[model samples]
Structures are given as structure tokens and as C-alpha cells.
Target: MTITPETLIAAAQSSKAWPFQEAQRLAKRMPKGKPGGVLFETGYGPSGLPHIGTFQEVLRTTLVRRAYEALTGGAPTRLVAFSDDMDGLRKVPDNVPNRDMLAQHLGKPLSRIPDPFEKFESFAAHNNAMLRDFLDRFGFEYEFVSSSECYNGGKFDTALKGVLSNFQAILDIMLPTLGEERRQTYSPVMPVSPTTGAVLQVPIEVVDAEAGLIRFTDEDGAIVEQSALGGMAKCQWKVDWAMRWVALGVDYEMYGKDLTDSGIQSGKIARVLGGHKPEGLIYELFLDGEGEKISKSKGNGLSIEDWLQYGSEESLGYYIFANPRSAKQLHGGVIPKAVDDYWQFRAALPGQELDKQLGNPVWHLLRANESHAGANAPGSGDTLPVPFSLLLNLVGVLGVGATREAVWSYLGNYVTNADPAAHPALDALVDKALAYNRDFVAPTLAKRAPSGGEVGALQALDAALADADPAISAEDLQTIVYEIGKQPEFGFDNLRNWFKALYETLLGSEQGPRMGSFIALYGIAPTRALIAEALAKA
Candidate 1:
């Protein structure tokens, strides 16, 4: 049956994780008049292609938002995918080819990196644009915020001021957490200028409200100063989380389990800085086909692009929604298997439940199926196909054309069951087709080439057909064969053998579908011509 936001939320609350309950606790403390919203942030390092892990975060957040919307019967909660492009180039990623160039741009804002494609204004923009494009393809509506924009806009001024005022407090909290040796070098934040390695011993008077500048004294007691524009934010990485919650008014956020400890640190800092803790939801990591973490920087990861080429969007959605949002590991290569299972799930759902699933965004497979079904007839607007058999049958005939519309039409007419609601067998067939499409590559039609056995079978079939009525149709030919097979010597096994012999003679294969149906679709004359060609080759 169709799963709604309420259902998902209920599921989450019932599960051991209880994210919704956690969200409720946080929601109760928020300002009474303000609507509760979730702020889902994913960092874009701008070092390499965004892997499937990135999509997982965005997709999960979007699904949660959708569920919220469904439950509230209001506009879905806002989701912002923030790109941390203002962050400096800390180190050259292992997979990036241009280490020297990237290192040359080190300590500079990610917005300043040269575009690898040489088309975008900067490397950050190129990556950001790619991410935006990918999200757009999936119909995700997110507020795109660049870290550069936030820094340049002075949105973090108050937060920065708060951080500075509480610097001693932050130091006290971090000192015990980070031993004294580590705390000495750490000033609660990192400040490295493009022109200098470390701006140490700077005067505290460099704190400019208007210019967003913060100054400090280095170990040598020298005045070292830097502007907030130079990637200097209100707080360090640990403190930044707390500052972001206040600055963006974030209510809910989820992260990978790998960062669970860091999330706790951020939550603690948030309590100190913002007087409130950001709702932190922890999710599990994704593994490759072999159950290993999919690391993009390591040049080993499955991308959304890779999945989309073979799997349907619905399948992807199914992959996301089927599992609990808890810290469960996912197998990337087995995504196809997930998609296949999702189709089966949809097919098995009650009619009304399936209808509901079709209406939900998390049920992307249903949507894809609907889109395919709708495009079946020209000028028919979009409609859903009746059953999976139509799709499989159409694929079997190799009638799936260049356009999705063509494929849809072929499926609607030939593959779908006449009455899916009533026909159990037909419904089962549809499920089988969905499984095949989800798990395996679509089969390609064999090229015409008659083998020696095929030539012999075709000669015998041709002689038989010639002796029979000239007007005998392909269907009639099947009936004739059935009649012959009724003989004790020519039973089902022999009939199968006879058909294989005929196929071998005509098409160079000992296997094929019913000759009558094949001939009817291929045309009697074309069938004869194919056999003649095969005979000539023999």
C-alpha cells in the first residue's frame, strides 16, 4: 500500500531511533508562532564528483520534508543544501589530477578555484551547478546557499560576535576535551591568510563590526589580523555548527553516523552559543556492492548518474524509502536489487494502497511507472500502464523505441494485462517483468543469421506449410502443430522439438517464441523472406 509522511513518521517514531520524537522534543521548545522546519545541509568540498552518498542525504531530507507536508497538510518544510565553498583548500584530494594547481589555490576560498571544465566561473560553481542539475532532474526544490554568499553577505556578523564574546567559554569547554598541547595551537578557530601562513599574536582590537574582521595575538604576541571575507567565519568547524543553527534558523538536521561524535560536539557548542541545541539525526553510511564505504575522494563510489543510466527514478526512491533512516549500511551496487524489490512491493500493495504510493514523492518508482504508462498513446496525456506483462511483452518484441513515449505505447497495447485488477496471473506476469527490468539489462533483439540446424528446420516447416492451405495464418499454423502433437508419437515434447527445428531452419536458432505469433508480428511474407535468405546462406 501507499506510504505517506504520517506513515513514515510513525514508522520512524516506532523504530528504535525515534527521530520524530526527538524532533517533537525540539519543536516543543521553539518559538510558538514559527513553523517548524528542517534545514538539511550537505557540504560540497568542490574537490571531485558528488557521489551517491550526497544524493542519499538530500533524498532522505526531501523525503522527510515530504512526509512532514503530508502529515501537516501544508506546504512542505524548507530544505537548504548549503555548499561550503567558502572553506579553504585544506589538502589536495587523492583523486584530483591537478594537485599542484589545487595547492596553488590553497588557503583561498573554494569559489576561487579554476573550473576543471573551463566553462564555469570557478571550480566551486562548476561542482555546485552539477549538483543543482542533478537535483533538478529528480524534481527536488531546495534553497541553494553558497558559503561564499553567506560570508560575503555579513549574515554571520552577529554569530561571529557571539563566538568572539564567548571565546573564553569555548576555550574552557574545549581545553579538557582537547588536551593542553593541542589547545595551545588551536585558538577555538583557524585563521590562515592567503598571504601569510599563520597570523599570530594579533591585537583583539582588530575585531571590526562593520568589516567583519577578527584579530588576535599570536604565540609570539604579534598582531595577526584577518577579514571574515577571507573564509573566516563566526566560529571554527566545531563552533560553526552552533552558529549556523542560529544564523539559518535551522530546526532539524541529519548526518552520517561517522560524524556522530562531531555532531555531539556541535550540539554541545550550540547549547553554549545559541542557548539551544540543533536537532541532530544520525544515519548510517552507504557501502559499495561488496559492503565497503563508498568514498568519492578515493575514486571509488557509485554516483547518482551511474544509477540513473540503468535504474528508474522510482527504483532509486524505493531504495531510499524501504530502509529505516537509522544508521544502517547500504550496498551501492545492490541498488538495482533494491529497485527490483521496490517494484515487487508496489505490485503487491492493495489497489488503494498502490494508488496512495503513486501519489507520494518517496514512491518515485510508482511515478516512473505512471510516466511510462501515461506516454503509451500519442496525445493521450500521461497514464499508467495496466500491468507489467505489457512492459515485458513490448521489450520481448524489441518494440521499445527511441522515445519513452514509444516504449510506453508498445507496453500499453501488448504487455499490460487486459484487466489487471481482476487478472491475478497477469498481475504476477507484470511483477516478473518489473523484476527483470529492475535487475537485468533489457535484452537486445538478435540479428538475423540462419544456422545449419535452422536451415533444416525451416525447410521442413516450409514444406509442411506449403502442403497445407496457402491462406493458413501463423495462428492457424500453431493450431496445426498442436493437432499434430496430439498424436501419441508427437506429444508436447515432440511439438517443442518440431518448433525448435522450425526455428533453427528459419532463424538459425533452436529456440524462439511461438512461431505463429512471431510470424504474425514479423509478417508472413517477411518470415518467408528470412527463411529464403537463411537457405541461401546455407
Candidate 2:
């Protein structure tokens, strides 16, 4: 179909892709009379190294921004990767170095603490640079915003004054949520200690709303009067979140589902500051393999490096794109399926209708940069003749520590066009598959004893394979296996059982690549030997 603006907008309106749905919500909530188009923002707390969660939020928000732009016929839009470096360093993160040095600076803003890595001027600066570098590596289009820069450079001066003016209103919204002791000491304004240079979390009184001044006790046991604006103080997290929305004119942002209550409270504070809260999405948090919520401190989830080691960057993006609302288990075990599924989606995109294409994750992923992250390079996409799972199995049979050249040579036998130099994407897949097979698949390889019926089936299959053509296609080989299973003397109840036996007794896994593909790639003679070996063990 010929895709036009009208058709694009119509598809976007009906598309069930989370990003498009979010974009439609943003379109409805956007304010009038603003010459600047919508501003999309994703906030990051620069307390630990940027994790997969960080990448996911930015990627998802970027997708929504692209969808919004498409729905508006290329309306000007900006995405801000805002960092909250000004947040206080409550405790030393377990994952960072120089824990003793970090502990000494606890209660100070992250931008003020010395860099534990000793690379940047401050701890937060080191983290912020890492975040920017990470995002830049992915070719993401965004403007990096620093809370410290905004606060110190007077960008938030006006909003800080607005907070002082609405102090009691914010108090009314926040006090009920706090415990009795915390309620007594809670203040929207968190003044910086004059002597200690740490953020003071003491009770404070609003001195003059119009003058933007507040009175509080410093850690030095001295009463001090300071302007609440111009970096002298910052609002607590919920308050600061609201102030940011008002200050930066952010139209859209997304947060983890754990922050839903905080979002609601921030929304009220945003209105109290005379600006509406941005349209927001609260997506489910990722869980570790054990079903516990992933935490940076615990190091319980897969990091960006961990995922990339076994899969393409595009695969990681696709995994994040598939489901935002549903909690997903992020771990090493999920990588193979994610990689294969990502390629499958790309392979299927060309055959889909426009609306379906719009909904496909690959379509959205390709919208920004078709070849971003070294994925889907020339001669790739649908042209990749093999699934990652198939290559993985090939590597498994080839044994751990198999070289790329060895696997390439084996693949060339089954596919004429399988050249590592020509298919860069497939070459990359080869590298990833080798790594996956070595790390995850090889350790679990064990040939179980075949059952009596499976032995009979394997014996018959070995005989059939001995007479089969060596140059048979994978499909033909699969048909031969199927027909043998259908014979009455084999005593197979179902094809699934037959396949299960093949995997458990031959491949040593409960699941495996298609037997036809495996046989074709491993060669007819080797497959016959594998069947004989299983029969020997029986």
C-alpha cells in the first residue's frame, strides 16, 4: 500500500503499540499557544552506573516521541535526558569503588561529592558522562539536561520561588503521607548547610514568600536565613519532580510502576506550582530470574553489557519494546529467545500491511536509524537465512570454543550465500551465538538414555537417514523425520513427544532448533551417527 500522511495518522490512531497509544494521549493533553512543539523527558538519578532500566526508559520515550511526531506530520519535538545529579548521596552505592570516600560525603548532593572513580570532578559528573556516552553510542537523538546545572545556573530560579509561595499548599499535599515523626520535620524546601556544604534536612519556616527566603538551622547549630531560589535550596523529590515539569515545559515522561504514588503526589504539587503535570506512563518494573524486582544495589538483573554479550543491541531494544506494562524477567537466559524473536520480527515486517507494520517493533526501531547499533546492515533483515537459535544449535554440536570460521564453514554447506564477509549482521550473530553457546548452552549439554519407544524410533530413523540424499533440504529432512514418526511400530503418541525425545536424548535440552534445520546443518551422516549413539546408550 502507498503510505501517505493521512494513512500514517490513521494507522497511528489505531495502532496498539504502546508508544503510539502514549503519543495519542500526549496529543490530547498538550497545551495550546506554545510555539515550541512537545518536549519529552526521561529523568535519571545519577546514583549508580546507568543500567538496562535506564536504557529502556530512554528508548521507550524516544519511541513515543517518534510516534507523536509521525502522528502530527513531523511536528517539532525535543527529548531531554534529564539527570538528577543534585540529589543527596544518602549512602554509598555497593557497586561503586571508594566506598569509604563516598561514605564520608554522605548527605551531600551527588554533584558535590568527590568522584569515587576519580575520573570526573564529582561523583555525579562521572555518572552523567557515562550516561551520555551510553546514549550517544546508540545514536539516540536527545539533549542532556543536568539538575545541578539547571539549579546553579538559575534555570530553576523562577520555579524555586514558585515553590516557596506554594509551600503550605505542598505541605498540605505531602504531610498526610508522612509518618508522624517525619511529618513534624518535613519541609518542601531543603536548604544547603552554609558551613557543612551538605543538604540540610531540618525543619524550616517560610520567611517571605515574595522574597523567596526561608529560615532554617544549619548542621553547625546556627540559625540561617537563605533564599529558597537560586540553588540555595531544593525541594524534596516529589516537589522537585513537579518543579522540573513546570520549569522545563515537559509534555511527556514515563516512570516505573513503583513510582505511581510519587507521580500522583507530584502531579498535585505541579498544579500547586501553577503548572500542569506532564502526560506520563507508569510501566511495570523488570524482575530478575528469581521473580524479585531488579535492583542496582543488589546487582540482580542483566546489565546492558550482559545482554549485548549474547545478543544484538537491537534485540535488547526489541525486548524492551515488546511489553512495557507487563513485568519481564531480565536475565541471561532470556537472551537467545529475544535475539531470535527480534530477527523474526524484522523478517516478517516486509510481508505485513501498513497498520501491522506500524505496530511491529522493528518498524519503530528502524524509524530513527535503520542501521543503528550495527544491526540490519546491508544484506540483512529478511535476507538472513538462519535464525539465531539454529546457529546456536549448530555451535552446540560443533562444541564449545568453536571458532567463527568453523561455524561459517559449516553454515556455507547448508546455504550457498552464507559468507561472513558479505553478511555482517549474520557475522555478528555468529559471534553472539558462539558466546551464548559457550557460556550458557555448553555447560548443560548431556545425552540422556532414550526410552524403549524412542530407541525403536531412533533405530528406524537411522536406517531412513542412511538411504536419504546428502543434499536434501532442511524441509525435506524434516519431512523424512515426520514420516518415520508416523509409522505404527514406532509407538510415538505425538510429534511433540518424538521431538522431546530427540532433544533430551540427542541434543541434551528440553527444546531445540528444528530437527530438519539441525540435520541439514550438521550433515546427514553426523545426524545418523547421533541417532546410533543414542541407540547405543539405550
Candidate 3:
């Protein structure tokens, strides 16, 4: 289908997806034909190693930028991945080594501290490299900004001077938000200790705005005075946030919900420094397997690399596409569904309305035009004949890391006229299913004896299969499982439970493809023999 500008723009403006809608909203809010084009920023703090949560900020920003460009006839857009490496190391994370070594150097700028991993110049460099590596692996189009270089090189000089000049005004913006205790010690520009090279959070007793200088008592109680512009001192998080916008003119940005308070304060500070705040959005945090909020410093979630090992990059993109405002899980268990959901979305696209087709997540995942839809949509056009769950069951039968030839061989043995080699989606499904089994679905599974109720269900299934022809459709097999679940003597009151019994007893897992479909593919004789073995154990 030809991608007319009208369909694409309408879909972007009216979509339920947050990124698409946000891009439309923010684009309209941009100055009527501004000279600077569009700039989107994703900020990261180098306090700990980059995690899965870090990807959301950049990915979400990229999505919105893409939407904006698509809607505006491919307008120029640039994404800046900014790292706040100049920030101080408040505490050492438990994930890395040399905690004691880092703890001793707490309160120092991140760039001033030695690398606990000893692979980079400093702790900040080590963490920043990790963030870059992740972005590179995904082939993201973005520019990297180092706060340390920007500050130390005088790139932030103008903003810093403006902040110092309007010190009192910015303080009034921040002081009202702080507690009595915090207000007393707060200074917008925190000074790095001259003696220890530590970032001092102590109150600034004097500010010579005219001379671009500030004085504060060091941790040792000695008075230290320094120039604020040449990286002698750095703005606190809130001030730094505003300073970045003023210097770079970031058009859009986002942060976690927990930082809303600081965000508001920083916006006020930015206005005081003669700059408007970036268009800001809030996203809900990701939780761990146990449902606790994922934290970079706490190390409470899966690493980005870990997730990628068991799932495709497209799966991760689906997770990001989910409710942007609701707390969600980032575990391996979500990976399989993410993969399946993308397939489902693509499978429904071809016959959809122009606007609907344009808004499909598959298009955004491909990051391409509607005419280029062929690039990412899985399967032949929109007819997705196989279920991903069924392919997962194949993973179990064939085992992990099975070759393409082996998978095709297995398919040929069961399903008539099957050509797994020609199926574009088969190989990926097998890989994901095995990874899901190993990383999320395998550990909780164990050998178990079938219950009496399920024994009847299995016997019923066996009798039905005994009379069945060698060839069967997935739909036919599904109907057989449902009919068996309805028999009174079986006591398989719920059809769902009956399916669970089949998966657990026969497949040794809690979930599987439709029973009829699985049985048909595995061949009626082999399926019946497996059920017989399960019944013998019972």
C-alpha cells in the first residue's frame, strides 16, 4: 500500500500508543516552523551499570521522534543520549567489586573515582561505555553527550554563568520544594572539594555571581573557594537538568514517575535562567520478577544483555510499547508473549484500515514508512497459519539449539507437506521458545504423577486418537481436547485445567499449544503412546 502523508499523520495523532500520540502533541506545540528542527533527549545517571530500565528512556524518546518525523513529512530530528557522568558517587553499588574502595571515595565526582571494574579510566567512564554499547548493539541513531566533557570543556559555561547570575531566583524555585533540613544545606551548584576532589553537598556560604565564584567549607571544615564555570563546580541534579536544556535546547524529554517533584523544580529553575523547560513526560517503572520496582543502583532487575540473550530485540521493543504509565514486569517470562504479540499485530495489519495499519506497532518496530511495511511484518502478508505456542512445543520435542535441518526434519515427520525451511517465522520461534524454557519456564517444572481425574481425561483422549486418521487439523485436535474435558466421569470440570494436565503430564510444562494441534503435529500414534506412558505412571 502506498503511504500517503494523510493516513500516517492521522494514525499518529489518534493512536492509543503513548509514543505516537505524544509525538503529535509535542510536534504541534513546537514553534510554528522553528529554525532548530527537533531535538529529543534521553538522560542517564552513571551511578550504576546500565540496566533494562535505561533502554526505555532512549527507546521511548526515539519512538516519539520517529512519529514526529513521519507525521511531518520526514522532518529533521535528532536524538541526544545524554549521560550525567559529572554527578557525584553518593554510594557504591553492591553489584560491582571494590565496594570498600569506592565507599572510601564516596562524595567524589564519578569521573574522579577509580573504576571498581578496572577496565576504564574511571567509574563514570565504565558505566558510560556500557550505556553506549547497548545503544550501539541496537543500531540506534543518536548522538552521545558526556556531561564531564561538556562541563570541563566549558560547553556548559554560558548556562552555568546564567545559573550563577540568577542564583537567588533559582533558589527560591527550589527551596519551597525541599524540607526544612534539606533546604538549609542545599545549594544549586554543588562544589567539588579542592582537597579531596569530592563533590561537596554542603551549603554554599558565599556566591560571587559577578566573578563566577562560590565558597564552601570542605568536608574537613576548611574554607574552599573556586570558579564555578570551568568545571570547578557542577550544578545539582535539578540545576544541571535545566542547564542542559538551556545549552542544548532539548525539545522533548522524559523521566520516571518517582522524579516528578525534582522535574517540576528543575523546570522552574530553567525558566529562571531565561530558558523554557523541555516538553517532559512521565513513564511508570519496571518491576522485577517479585514485583518490586527495578532500580539501577539496587540491581533488582535483569540486565539488558541478559534479556537480549534469551529474546530478540523486537521482543524488547514490544515490552516498551506496552502501557507507558502502568508498572510492568521486565522478566524473561514476558519475552515469549512479546514475540507472539508482535506476530499477532503484524498478522492483523494487511486487511486493516489505512489509519489502523499505519498505527500498528509492527510499523513502528521496523521504524520505516508504510510502503516499507514488507520489511518487518512476519509471515506471508496477513495470513499467519501457525500459532507461536505450537512452535514452542516443537522446541521441547526437538530440544534446544536444534539446527534448521533438524527442525525441518521433525516438521516433515509429523505435518504433511510441512516446509519449516521456507517458513520465515519458524527459526525465531524455536529460538525464543527454548530460551523461554531455560530462562523462565524450566526451573519451576518437575516430574509429577497424573491425578485420577486427569487419568480419565487422558484415557478419553487416547480412545479418540486411536480411531483418528493419520492426518488432522489443529482445529480438529482442539475440538477433541474440549470434548474430552466435558465428559462427566472425568471430573475435569474446567477445560483450562484439562489442558494444563496435558501440558504438565505429557509436556512436563504448565503451558502448551492446543492439545489437538499438538497431537496432530506429533502424529496420532506417538501422542497416544506418550499419554499411555503418563497414565501408566499414574
Candidate 4:
């Protein structure tokens, strides 16, 4: 079927996906008959290596951009990935090397500081390169913008002058948000020192809006008058953000929940500069495995490298795409479920109606156009015949020392067409499962002795499996296991406990694959042996 722009736009208008919803919000703010269409911007601070959160912001913004394109019937759009490299480095980051050397450059712009690793022209340059590489590896289409270039090359001259003119207005909007002590020294403009090359945080003594200049006292008690434009000065954090939005005419941007107040204050500053503030989503921050807020300085959160090491790229995107509002514990443990969910969604997409398909996260992640449809979706060739969670459990049962060949041998029995060479995705999943089993599952595995009643149930299960045909279907086998559990003679008041006992005793885990599937995959004789081994423990 031919999918026209009207179908896509109708789907986008009615779709409840967060990206489409954000795009709908953005449509209201779009300027009438703007040249070069709409602009979407995402900010990055190049004080350190870009983390997954940075990638997430760009990915989320790109999602919205794609939805906007669909909403506007393929109107032109540009995504600017802005890096704030001109901001001062207040202190040394705990993650990087050469702490003593970096300490000397404190209060200097990140773009001006020496690279700790000595790879690029400046500290921020090294980090900026890394950020670009990170985004490039993910295939994100964006134009990279350097804050230092904008400030130093006179690109922000008019915006800087606007800030100078509205300095008082910005101060009024900002001062009420600060505490009593902070309000005393607060200034919208931060002049870069000519002698020291540090971004001065001192209060501005005078602002010449006409000449685009500011006067301030340096740290050495020297009173200085400096050009507010052409790299001589930069705005404070909130003001800088607002000035950027105004200068770029950004249509949309998104930030972490922690910065919601800052976004609001910056929006006010943007309006003060005679430019409209961009509409955006305020998403919750990612947390560490311990449920503490992820800090780049502390190196506590999962990096993009870490997530990709254990899961596919699509799985990582799926994890980020699920819920922008809810905080998530990002770690190694979440990868398996993410992989399974990604495939599950992909498999379901072909059957869903147009509206539901548009709402599906996989639709946005995989489909290029409405006509790209689920049957021929990009990356659909990589779908695994088996779920990632089942693969993980297979590795769990086979021990951490399980080999790829051994996994394929069992998989071949369950899925006759399952060939490691043909199923590259399955092959990769097997490797990830083995690695996860080794790192996370192996250490925690401990077989506990079964209760007296559970022993009887195990015996009954083993006997039942021994008498049944070895070629029974997985679903039929499941019925048998369910029936055994439901037997009043087994004394299981709750059916869940019966499965829990099986997992604890047989798999040494609190959770496991379906017993029917496990038995069918492991073979009836091997399962009987496993049951005998569990009974012998008594």
C-alpha cells in the first residue's frame, strides 16, 4: 500500500508517543514562514567525556525531530548539537588524569585549558572530538556547534549586545531565584580576563548596552572594561543558555529534570532578549545501580561503551525511549530485558494498526517512512528467533563456562533453522549472555536444598517427563508442568511457589526460563538427571 504524507501526518497527530507529543507541542511554537524550516538544538558541556546521558539527549531530540518532520509533511529541519566549551572549568574532574596540571588552569575556559591526555589542541577540544565520535557512532545526523567558536568568532555578537541591553531585566528574573548571599554578587554577564584568561565571576560594575561592553573588577582587584562580544566576555550559565536559544533561533530543546528551574529562568531571559524561548521536554535523570543520582564526576553511571559492550545498539535506544519522565537504574542487569523488549516490539509492529504502529517505539526507531512498514523494517533481518532472556537463562543453566558452540547445539534442537552463521544477532546475543552469566549470574548462583513437598513434586515431574514423548511441543510440555503444579497432592497452595522452587533448586536462581521450554531445550533425559541430582541433595 502506498503511504502518503497525509497518512503519516494523521498518524503523527493522533499518536501518543512522547516524541510525537513533543513535536505537537513544538508545532505551536514554530515561527510562520521561517526560512530554512525549523531548528532543534541539544547542548553538551565538554568538561569531560560525553556520557550516555549526553547521547540520550541527542537521541531524544532526534526522535522529536523525526516526528516533527512527519508532522510537518517532510518540512526541512536542522539539529544543532551545541557544545559549551567556553565555560570555565571550576575544578578538576575526578575521571581525567593530570590533576595537578588541571588545578593550575582552574577558572579558565575549558576551550583554553591544556588537554590532560595531550591529544587535542585544548581540553575541551579533546572532549568535543569524543562527543562527536560518540554521536557519529550512533549514526545521529547533526551539525556540531562550538561555544568557543560562537563567542570568539563574533557569531554571538548581537546576542551578547542583547544581553547587555537587558542585563537589568535578566537580573530581575534571576535574583528572585537565588538565595540572599548569592543575590549580592549575582551578575548576568561574566567578563573574560585579558591578563589571566579566566572567566571572571565577579559582579559587573557597569553595562554599556550601546557599545556592547561591561566593566568589572578582576580577582587581582584591577578594574577592567571589556567588550562583551568577540570572546571578551560570556554570560552566566542561565543567561548563556538563554542567549544561545535566542541567537540560534532554536525551536526545540530538552534538558534533565534537575535543570527544570534553570530552563524556566533561561526561557525568561530569552524573552527578555526579544526572542521566543524554545519548547522542550524535561526528562528525569539517570541513576546509578545503587539508586543514587548518576554523577559524571563520580563515574557512577553506565557509559555508552558499557551498555554497548553487553547489548545491541537498538536495545540501548529502547531503554532510553521507554519513559523520559521516570528515573531508571542504568546498569549491566537491565541489558537482557532491553534486548528482549526491542525484538518483541519489532515483531509486534507488523501486526499493529496504523495508529498503534505509529505509537510503537520500534516504529520511530526502525521505520524510515510510513511506507517502510514493519514487514520490511530496517534491522528486521537481525531479529533473533529466541528471546534474549531465554538465551540468558540457557547460559545460566549451562554454567558460565558455556561455549558458543554448545549454545548453538542446544538452540539447533529447539529451533531447527537456528544457525549461528545465519543468525548473527542470535550469535551476538549468545556471547552477551555468556558474558553476563559470567559477570552477574555466576557469582550469585547457589543451589538450595528443596523442601520435602518440593522433592515429591520434583519426583512426580521427573516421572511424568520420563513417560511422556520426548517430541512433545513446548506448549504441551508447559501444560504438563502446570498440571503437576496444580495437583492437590503436591501441597502447593500457590502455583508461583512451585515454579520458584524449581528455579532455586534446579537453576540456582530466583527466576528462570519456562520449565517446559527448559526441559524441551535441555532434553528429557538431561532434565531427569537434573531432577535426580536435586533429589539426591536431600
User: What are the runs in model 2 whose C-alpha is more than 4 Å off?
Assistant: 31-33, 368-380
lDDT on C-alpha atoms for all candidate structures: 0.55, 0.86, 0.77, 0.85
For residues 268-370, what per-residue lDDT tens digits would candidate 1 score against the true structure?
Answer: 7777776565565577776655657766655454566655654555666666654444433443445545544555655444443433433433344332222
The CA lDDT at 288 in model 4 is 84
- Tens digit of per-residue lDDT, candidate 4, span 232-255: 888899999999999998988999
The sequence of per-residue lDDT tens digits that candidate 2 reaches over residues 1-538 is 5578888888888888888998888877752314676899998999878878889999998889888888777788888999999889998888788999899988898999999999999999999999999888888899999999999988998899898888888999999999999987789889988787788788898889888889998887789998877677888999999999999998899999999999999999999999998887889999999999998778898889989899999899899998799999998889888888888888878778888888889888876553355432322455567788889988988888689999998887687787877778889989999899988999999879998788888888898788887778889989988987888787888898889889998888888988999999888887887788788887
The 10-residue segment with the lowest total lDDT in model 1: 375-384
Q: So what's the TM-score on candidate 2?
A: 0.96
For each candidate in turn, the TM-score is 0.63, 0.96, 0.88, 0.94
TM-score-sorted candidate list, best first: 2, 4, 3, 1
The TM-score that candidate 4 achieves is 0.94
Instruction: Between candidates 1 and 3, name the one with more favorable lDDT.
Output: 3
Which of 1 and 4 is ahead in TM-score? 4
lDDT of 4 at 522: 75
Ranking by lDDT: 2, 4, 3, 1
Report the backbone clash tally of model 4: 0
Expressed as tens digits, the lDDT of each residue in 329-354 for candidate 3 is: 87767766776787788777766776
Q: What is the lDDT of candidate 1?
A: 0.55
TM-score of 3: 0.88
